[model samples]
Target: MTPDEVIAAWDQPGATASIHPTRGISEGAYWASGEAQAALLAQDIPAGSRVMDFGCGDGRVAIPLRALGYDVTGVDASPNMLAALNRHAPDLATFRSDGSDFGKHLGRRKFDAVYCLAVLIHHSHETGQQLVERLRAVVRKGGILVLDWPVADEPAETNAWIGVTTWSRDQQDQITKRLGLTRLDVDRPWAVYQA
Candidate 1:
């Protein structure tokens, strides 16, 4: 999807607005800092990892990652969302950029990890494939990619992946292969990739 398409559809209303029905989503948004720490704790996510949260809303991950002392930067298209995030995480640094073009905000700061949780699913799988390419470029070699979204062909109105396109196992394998990444097991809610 082009920037305009993203802005019009998802960024404006096409993307996952927020996780509803999931009690955790509410808790995380309210206490983003703690939620980040708890979520990362279960994973192999390292301390001091340079992290980027694409489409970070209210710093649900960004705030906690920051609290953990990871060099974190968040990018989102909504000023309202960013403002809400800033309110909770005042020290948080953010940039208003669409997911399609994060280069200007990123500059030369390649991250140790790049995450687009349910963010890429806003577009079609073909577009998601392109995003895999773009996102891979933002991370240093050997970095991790935390790609998350529900696996299905169609989008779900209540869930994050609803109405959005997604990858089949074969599609995922092919794209990761081209990027020189190895699939590390799907962690239910999120897909893990190691470059």
Candidate 2:
């Protein structure tokens, strides 16, 4: 699907319902390992630091980080998603923007850290490069950027809904290098880069 189509699908009624709280774990838990991962990421950053969760669907990561006392902002292409996020996290800030061009929506704002999880794989290679550049522009020097997406040795496969494009380690290495980012960690699908 095109980027607009993907956004429309996500904004449809009940599109985000499945991600809401379940019987045991809450929605945030179901999305980001029950907030454990978010806590880990927030551990090093001092309280009140600014963080942005790019493609921050329904506050999965943003809410938890906010709860940890960081100034968190959730950015996504879907207003419906941002609305849903507001319902759960009313005080958290949100902005509407596509993954490939969030810097424009943010104006001169920069973040101490950025989270772009489960987002990059939906874009083609060219679009992904644009997204990396935009994301880089928003992150402050010496800040961190966390990325997590499926990776495989096989060629990337695009679905009828949100297209999926997998990247190999080499591809990711080149991206970090081009962006002048230092790799801090590499655990399978997750890579932490310091700008």
Candidate 3:
């Protein structure tokens, strides 16, 4: 799906489950997962560093990351998702985007790291590549980017909003090279790249 389509889909009711279906089964489990992810992010991004939680839905990860001492900002295309996040962490910063003009949203600003979980898998290959490139652009050189971009034996593109897109190792490597990203050897589910 294109970024605009994804944004529209996310704005509809009951879209949080599309972000993480099983995690939303219980509120305890849902927020616990965020804390766990925040812990993993903390290992790479130093405490108190400025960070952006791209595709952050309802402060699930952003809230916990902020509690861990990072100045975390939530960026999402859906106003409903952002509204839900604001309800929980009213003070946490947020930016509305459709993945087109991120630079305009952060004029003269850059983050130490950015993490985009459960986002790229929902986009087509071309859209996913563009999203990754845009994400890389918002971070400073040597900054970190953690993405839930998966790899499979056969590369595939997602046609639905809730579908998964997988890339081959060679394809991932090529994007890493093209984006000047140095893959980090991290013990996490998501791939960690250095800008």
Candidate 4:
């Protein structure tokens, strides 16, 4: 499936997922990680650097980044998620649109970092690859791309429980390499990348 096809399939109950408080899904923990991720990304981008929080769900990173004094624009496909963000991070810039299409929604604007965690797993390999490219365009060359997702031994086209799709580690690595990304690390519950 194409990138649009992959996300399009996830339009149903795909937005529903269990939140792990001890990990990224938890509000506090997620915020702390966002700070850490921001710090790592800050090493590459300046304080006023603009960040495109692609697939930003419930303002996990957007709220923190906005607090850290970074110009952030959070984008997500789920209206429910966007609503939560609208309530939590009202001051932050937000665009309700598909993560794979940030380039168009935001125009030719380029960001210093594209922080997308727990988002890419919703797409199949094809869509996931396209998303990587789209996000690359969303960021300026040499920009940071912080991301994380669930990894499985086998890739799948559909997850009925979540009403989404996903790619395996191998698939993800291959696409990242193809996109000329430099993988910083890949430990469970956390992954970092830069372009």
Tell me the lDDT of model 4 at 57: 72
Model 4 per-residue lDDT tens digits across residues 101-160:
565677788888887776666556566667777887777778777766556666566543
Model 3 C-alpha lDDT per residue in residues 1-195, reported as the tens digit of each score? 888888888988888765665565887888888898899899999779999999998998999999988999899989999999999989999989866888788986889999999888988888888888888888899999898999999889888888899988898789879999999987899999899
For residues 62-106, write the lDDT of model 1, one tens digit per residue. 776676677778877767668768887877778886656767776
| Candidate 4, residue 138: how far the Cα is off, in Å | 1.1
Better of 2 and 3 by TM-score: 3
The most accurate candidate by TM-score is: 3
Off by over 4 Å in 1: 1-6, 9-19, 23-38, 153-162, 186-188
Pairwise lDDT winner, candidates 2 and 3: 3
C-alpha local distance difference test of each model: 0.67, 0.76, 0.88, 0.68
What is the TM-score of each predicted model, taking all chains together? Answer: 0.77, 0.85, 0.96, 0.73
How many residue pairs in model 3 have overlapping backbones? 0
Per-model tally of clashing residue pairs: 8, 0, 0, 1
Candidate 3, lDDT over the whole model? 0.88
